[model samples]
Target: MPMVDTGDVRLHVQRMGPRDGHPAVGTVLLVHGLLTDSLASYYFTVAPAFAAAGLDVVMYDLRGHGRSGRPPTGYTLDDAVDDLAALLDRLAVTGPVHLVGNSYGGTVAFGYAARHPERAASVSLIESEPATAAWAAKLDGILRRVQRELAYNETDALAWITVNRGHNTARLARGAARLARETTLVRDIPASSVLTEDGMRAVGCPVLGLYGGDSDLAALVPWLEASLPDCRTVVVPGHEHSVLVEAAGTVGGHVLALIEGSGGRGPGRVSIPGGGGGRASGAAGPAVR
Candidate 1:
């Protein structure tokens, strides 16, 4: 459970790969969604695939989520990206590194790429949308539904989870309840800055947009194609918003391809001369969820 000081808050970060101390072909940062989501989603899903494919893997629990420090405020999109910049600086992860984000995490990656194009090798969004007004509106709808259906109080949420979703989903539901009760996420997110169309267009790197064929966010593919000059879009049939969880293997293959295609080449990739089999250096603190 190593934490990195971002000047503003402490972030729980996990780096994984072979411990052989091999230099990685490139670096890939995995960003998870909001609420109950944490680095564990990626850690258990696509991360190991990237690691085995000879890329450095970095995953962190976003502020106010998981083991990261949760402040009373500063849950805005801009704030999240700034925290990412500071973490990268602290870790001395120079050059253009791949950013792979799921759900709201994709918005963070998009914001970061827009602000720091020079530092981004490529950006991948899984079941995510650009932080546009439309997306904000959609988010509002989802939140409204959540408020109406789910309990914000820990006790009630746990009770609902146990009765409805059983033990497995209850675990995640409990975490979500804790975050809702303890943090300002529900309030801060609505007030967070949204990315304008101009902002989305400003990102100067290749983009990969993956969405479920039936997902509410599926429209984002056409949007990306119309906006980004170098964007690739993929739609997984028979899936919905939970593509990252339901179809992780398919998603992992796409990510590995991206790393192989862009993460080991010229300026976009960071070459680590002979160090073992392209393993990223372990974080200073022990790896934790």
Candidate 2:
């Protein structure tokens, strides 16, 4: 738990690596989705691969999420991206970094890339979408569910766990309230700022659009590939929205291939979904879906 001062914002960020290492294969800045902040989104996965690959992995809670400061209530996709940009600037993190965003994180990533193409190495989107009326409605439902769960008092927190999002619920009650109060996703995603899928095309780096190959995978993938020239798709044969927590290593392989390049220069067909995939980095792929 470390805090970085960005003049106007005190970002609560987490880092895992040596102070000085390989100048970082480019920092992997992960943005979590609705109801989830840092750590909860990546604690068991991804971080290790980036660390093992000798890259700096950084994750921070957006303005009103996690432990970050929450002023009255102001959170928007544009503002979240700006905060991210500011944090990077303050840390002197240069060059485009591999940006991994899940759920709503993907929304901010798309916005940031739209505004600053020079700041991205690549983008890995999980169970995500460009905001549309349909998308907004979908999110509205999830937000309502989250709010409902958060209503549980300490006495019923654990009992409320089973119906919630996380793959694990040992800390469900407290985590739910944290998520409920961190309404950045609710406050920002509902706006039209997130409706610009065209923005994804402006990014100057590689793009990996992933889906939980289950019945829920929207036509968004084909639509994205059709719209964004640099974008590609990967559908985990069997998975769902919370795929990250379910299958970390499996997901990492596909991500490493696209963003960092799997670099899996070995024997045989190294076909890791996403045609633009790189050589396998020796790290096993995480479970998809």
Candidate 3:
């Protein structure tokens, strides 16, 4: 368990690579979403796959989540981006590298790429949209609802999910409830801004997007197509927002492909254990990653 001090806070960070000891071509940073999400989301799922594919993998618990120092404030998007920048700086991770983010993590990746295009080699977004006014407003509504539910009925909500939903669902609900009850996540996320159209257009790196066919965020894929200069997307069938969990192998395959392509390397020969070929047909062209 290593923690990197980013001046403002200390982030719980982990670095991993292939057990066979192949040299890593470039770095791949994994960022998770809001609420109950943590570095573990990627740590236990896709990080090892990237490592096995010969890329240095980095993942950190965001402020107010996991084992990271949880300051009461500084949970906004700008703060999140700054934290990433500082982490990279502290780790001496220069040059362009691939970024893989899930949900809100994806939004941070987009924002960071737009802010510092020179440092990003490529980006892979999972079930995420640009932080636009519309997204911010929509997120605000969702956060408010979560805040309301957590403020008054968190225990009941957890109990209800435990009985009605599966154990994983109950666990996630409990974690979300505890975080909501303890941290300023509910207050800070709603205050963050989604990137504008111009901001989205500013990201110059190639991007790979993975989304669930049935996810609410899938609607943002067309917007990504219209905005990013080079974007490839895949919509996995029979999945939803939890693509990272439901289809980790598929997501990991695409990500390894992205890293391999970005580094101008040959195909990475690793199989996603339970991952299917979750690629949607007619994905802008043949799968580049």
Candidate 4:
């Protein structure tokens, strides 16, 4: 277990380089979603594939999640963005790097791009959106519900989750309950500052949005394409919010295309199947070698 003390909080970090002593084509930083998510999501899914494809991969547990230091405060989006910047600085990776974020992690990645546009090579948002007013409100409602149902009604909630979502999910839910009860994460996140339209438009790097066709978030594709300077989106068919985990191949393919298109060196051709209103055929194209 590797950890980096970022002055603000100690973040649990994981890094993987290209196989067989090959130089990395580029660097990729993977950020996971809030609560029930950690670097494990990408580690078990896309991280290895990216590394095998000759990209350096970096993943970390955010503050108050996984094995990272949880201060019971500083759970704002800015804190997350700052942590990323600091982590990269400490790791001595100063060049612009590709960023792949899941759910709330995408929001943080978007925030990082907006804040430090020069350092972001590209951003791939998997079932995520920017930290806008609407996003904040949505998070507020969700957090409140979690605090009420998971924290306030712990025993019943765990029992229900164990029966419905299985013991693994129930165990994760138990940790979430402790986080919500012991930390200010539920409040700090909603109160974090949101980005304005101008702020969003300032991020000039290439952006990729991957959403499930059946997810309500698919509705944002049009807005994302319209808002970002260089934005492309894909709606994966027959999936929902958990698309990254459920459809890692599709997600990995699209993300690899974005990374290659952004200037990483690779032999294969990059082709994205869906954009805007189009739906992906569920083929993730050729596997990266």
RMSD of each: 9.1, 5.9, 3.9, 6.0
Judging by TM-score against the true structure, name the best candidate. 4
The best candidate by lDDT is: 4
lDDT by candidate, in order shown:
0.73, 0.65, 0.77, 0.82
Return the TM-score for each candidate structure: 0.82, 0.78, 0.88, 0.88
Q: What is the lDDT of residue 47 in candidate 4?
A: 83
Native-referenced Cα lDDT, model 3: 0.77
Measured on C-alpha atoms, candidate 4 has an lDDT of 0.82
lDDT of 1: 0.73
User: Relative to the unseen true structure, what is the C-alpha lDDT of residue 7 in candidate 4, on a scale of 0 to 100?
Assistant: 97
RMSD of 3: 3.9
User: Given candidate 4, what's the lDDT at residue 203?
Assistant: 91
- After superposition, the stretches of candidate 1 with alpha carbons farther than 4 Å from their true spots are 148-168, 262-289
lDDT of 2 at 211: 71
Output the lDDT of residue 29, model 4.
Answer: 95
